[model samples]
Target chain A: MELVVFSLLNGVLYGLLLFMLSSGLTLIFSMMGVLNFAHASLFMLGAYLAYQIGRYTGFWPGLVLAPLIVGLLGAAIERWGLRTVHRFGHVAELLFTFGLALLIEEVVQLIWGRAPVPYTVPSSLDFAAFTLFGTTYPAYKVFMVLISIGMFGLLGLVLTKTRIGLIIQAALTHPDMVAALGHNVPRVFMLVFGVGSALAGLAGVIGGFALVTSPTMARTLGPIVFVVIVVGGLGSLTGAFVASLLIGIVQTFAVAIDFSLIDLLARFGVTVTRADTFYDLWRIKLAQLAPVLPYFMLVLMLIMRPRGLMGTRET
Target chain B: MPIIRRALLGVALTLAALPAAAQDSIKIGYIDPLSGAFANVGELGVHHFQFAMDRINAKGGVLGKKLELVPLDSKANPQDTQIALKKVIDDGIRFVLQGNGSNVAHAIVDTLSKHNEREPAKAVLFLNYAAVDPALTNDKCSFWHFRFDADADMKMEALTNYMAKQQGIKKVYLINQDYSFGKAVAAAAQAMMKQKRADVQIVGDELHPLGKVQDFSPYVAKIKASGADSVITGNWGNDLSLLVKAAKDAGLNVDWYTYYAGGLSTPAAIGQAGKDRVKQITEWHSNVEAAALDEELDAYKKKYNEDFYFLRTRNLMEMLVKAFEQAKSADPVKVGIALEGMKHQTPTGEVYMRADNHQLIQPLFVSTMSAGMKRDVENTGLGFKTDGRIEAKDTETPTTCKMKRPSA
Candidate 1:
């Protein structure tokens, strides 16, 4: 029972982190209609930038400044890089981002080398926050959860209450209609792109301290982020939020649970031994299956309900 | 008419003599991860060999001719490795160096063995540097291949024997990255524990996916609940760093966490946060005070702006050069015969390549991060000291290889 509760909490935190990264990707895809393959690379850049800034100015300054730097760079990329390629259509735009991802990876290797950088958690959050069922939870995790929720709330307000939020909502649903109403749709696209990339950068900043800031982190987290965005639906933030949280909890719970197929067979009084290929399936662990579960869920959802749970359109 | 005939005869004789004395340059191929996540380590390996080759040429060339190294990027993938190996073979390279990962090594070995059987004259010689999977030396042993590093069983035997002697070690938890290397290490550890330490109990065994796992809290919590005093793993690269960070964050009381591989010698992998949390075993260390190691260490540090821990490739290359020199030829068959049962001294220590298994028998160093070393150790000049060195033992175990030397 204690393990279950702890895993659930862990799952929620992990899911929230995924959401922070994926929400931006989903928003950008919905608005721009081009899947930015380099979104994860931008996240990696954010983490690397935070690691550098945090070394000199401390962690708190990194938390605020790194995302802004990433946002401005993202704006530049959208203006000069992606916009030029957009003339050739969405496939060309995607290819550009794909090339951009490759370049960013090389750039990271040139700057940081290939070894995993050891970005430490802040000393303030180094201590355990509280004890649950005789197990202490680190304060950094609670901070991660708080930051993720705070970012979600900030994004919610920006999408709901602000004038820019109203403009974005109009553009999201009907770009042509918004352009007819004298709103500069192209500038709006640029803002959304910049803001979306900033969100990815924010996730990277928190994630770098939370995990190892390695070049591989982008490759490792890239597909999972895409899965979350796609599973939650193409244009629905609420759907993305739900999907991220669900995928996280599922993966967390799956890894924690261990039950072999042999155990199931044993319950039915069936004894089979010395069979080849039995060892292969019996040796499968839940944790080993955790990484592929989200993709599996994504495939199932795509087949069963093309729009996803909260997706606005079939994508 | 007589003068013209004499001139034509002299020119024909000169052209014939040129083809006999000057042979084609011996091409050695290197295939490994060169452009991906594992690129730095792979590139370092490449650089070490290139540096060695430059020095060798400067002294005077090998076999009275210059060495041409042909490098192909594997990207640490088996498919890529297969393609690269085929390309090397097609380019008429007889000697190859690889083995970054077990899966890639296994694929290359299997393909090479098949090719060797079909065409004996085109047989390739392999020098495996860092792939430590035991099966490659045991069940998958090849006559044409030589493994320079310690295999999984050897490392596990050392680790388990050390753990058995230590007091206060009760329950052991086994966790590893779910792959060929990880599974092999875990199995070896388990077998060693059962055979050596009866008091030690294995509470839990788990495996996590490679590079796909971000949160290690569940696994940490499981370890805590299992009441294990020690945790044993074979995880390397990013997985090692991430697991240590997560385990520390979860307040898991790991009295001893033995790494079969990973962060064993690389300071970059462990960082400042992990210095106190883990102890590593490796082939070489920067602070090990040996007379033979000092000169090589100084040269490597001066050239590479980094410590000398990534010298496994250099050691392997030196061994290859020695074998070739001893054989007095670049022939794979003669080189293999010369290398078998060969004993040489390395910067690390004396190493013996066993005739039976072709696995290098060398000293293994166990080291811990130095206390009072500041976090800026990479920049501020701090180093690790060797706590123990396990010398080569004579507990002879039969290798799984059945083939005998073909009357060489």
Candidate 2:
């Protein structure tokens, strides 16, 4: 029971963190139709900048300042870099961002070297928030959950309630109609791209504290964000949220349940012979398969629900 | 017409002298991961190899030929290593050094041993600096391959020997990166612990994916719940550092026995998280007071801007030079014969390659990190203090290798 509770809680926290990064990509992909391959690079930049800022001014200020710097830089990237590449079509824009991701990784390594930086949780939030069934949970984890929920709420309010948010939504469904009605579609596209990047930056600031702050943080988190966005349907924010939690919970639960395929097959009266050449394949437990579970969900979602769980339009 | 003919003759003579100029130096291939997740450790090792050669070159050329190190990036992949090996062989280099991943080492050893069998005249010697897979020196051992670092079982034997004497440590947890090397460590530790201290309970055993985990908090949570008093792991690089950091943040104050505690950037990366609790089993630590290698150590550290990490790398170069001097030839076959049973002196102690397995038996140290360290890497303001030293003779384990030597 304790295992179930802890795994679910941690899984939700992890899913929320994924949502924090995936939400921006969802908006940008849905509104702008650009995949933003370097989105995770911006996430890495935020982590590295936060690590640098936290080294001087402390974590609280780093929390505020790092994302702002990344957000502004992101806006500049949309304004100057992506806008310039927009003329070359989506394929070209994706290639540019991919190249940019490699360059950003090199730059990070050049500055920080190829090892993990000591970007630890601050002493104030370093202690456990509370003990659960004799297990201590760090306060920083709760802080991550709070910040992710807060961002989701703010994003929800901005997309659904505000005037520009209404325009972005209208553009999502009826870009031609909105453009025909004289809305500056390019401006809306840039806004979505910039705002989406800021969210990823925010995710990085919190996630770095949760993980190791290193040049490859972006690479580590890059594929999972895509899995979340894709499994949620490319453009559906709510679907991304649902997929995030679903995938997160499923993966977390998979890790906790240590059932081997051979052991499982044995219960059904199928014995695994030691002489089998491929015996090692059957030896893998669910815990070892946890990392690949998200991708399995990805493949299943693409085949079964191409439009995603709650997706309005086909992706 | 006579003047033009004389100019052509001069050009031909100059071109003829080029191969001789190259012949005045022996080119050794140092192949390892240079651009991947393991690049930091690989690059550190390359720097050590280059520095070791510089020291050898200063003392006059070995066999009157300057030892030149040719570095090639293997990208930490076996296929890439094979391609790199072929390229080096094609270039007439008969010796290669690599030591980050045992997978890469296996690829090199297999490729080179096959090459040596197929073409005895062009046989290449694969000198290992730090891949500690027991199979390399045991069942899967190759005649053309020589390991300069102690195998995993030897290090674990030394480690568990020290572990047996400790007062506490009722319950122990075994955690490692899920791979061949990591699995070997866990299997070896479990067997040795059972042999040494049957009463100690192995409360938890887990293997996480290698280099893929972003958060070790859940894993650390599991460790805390296991009621473990001591944790043993073979994790290195960022994986090891993150594990230590997570344990510290969660206030799990268990003693950690690790394989890569003093690896590149790890000790510093752990910082205050592992000041006194983290311990490592290694051939040499930077804090060891070795007066003999002081001058070389000072100059080497100054050039690299980081403390020397791999003592086996230094031993490799020093032994290679001695082999050349004794054999009086730069031929790979002759050098290989000389290196098989070579006894070389490192600053810590004298070590010899066991003739049966080609495993270097060197003095091993069990050390821990703390402040006011006499020596530190990355200015971490920390140093490793030795807890125990296992002499070279004490670390010998019987090998299962039945080497297939080339028939003369």
- For TM-score, the strongest prediction is 2
DockQ of 1: 0.64
lDDT of 2 by residue, A1-315 (tens): 777887887678778778877877887887777888888988888888888999899888988888888878877888889989989998899998999899999999999888777776778887888877666677888888788778778877888899988999898679899999999877787777777888778888887777777877788788988988888887777888889889878877777766888998999998998788788789888887776889888889889988777777774
DockQ for each of the predicted structures, in order?
A: 0.64, 0.49
Chain A TM-score compared with the true chain A, each model in order: 0.95, 0.94
Per residue, candidate 2 scores C-alpha lDDT tens digits across B1-408 of 999999999998998878775667889998998997777777887889888887788888787788888999999889899888989999899899998888899999888888899999888999998888888999989888999888899999999999999979899999988888888889998999998999999987788888776556567767877889999999998889889887876678799999888867787678778888999999998888797777777887789877877888878887888888888888788888898888987889889998898899899999998788777655677789999999999999998999988774
Candidate 1 local Cα displacement, residue A301, angstroms: 1.8
Across residues A144-242, which tens digit of lDDT does each residue of candidate 1 receive? 788777777787788889998899888877989999999998788889899888988988888887877888778888999888888888877888888
In the range B1-408, model 1's lDDT, one tens digit per residue, is: 989999999998988787543364678899989987688678777777777777777777777776767889999999999889989888778899986888888888899888877777887888898887777778888888888877777877776766788777899999888887788878888888999998899998888887777877777878888999888888776676667767777777684455532332234544554555466666665665666666765686589765555556677767777878999998888888899988888766678888888888888776666655322234423355566777776223457975434444
In order of the candidates, what TM-score does chain B achieve?
0.87, 0.96
Which candidate has the highest lDDT of all? Answer: 2
Residue pairs that clash (backbone atoms under 3 angstroms), model 1: none
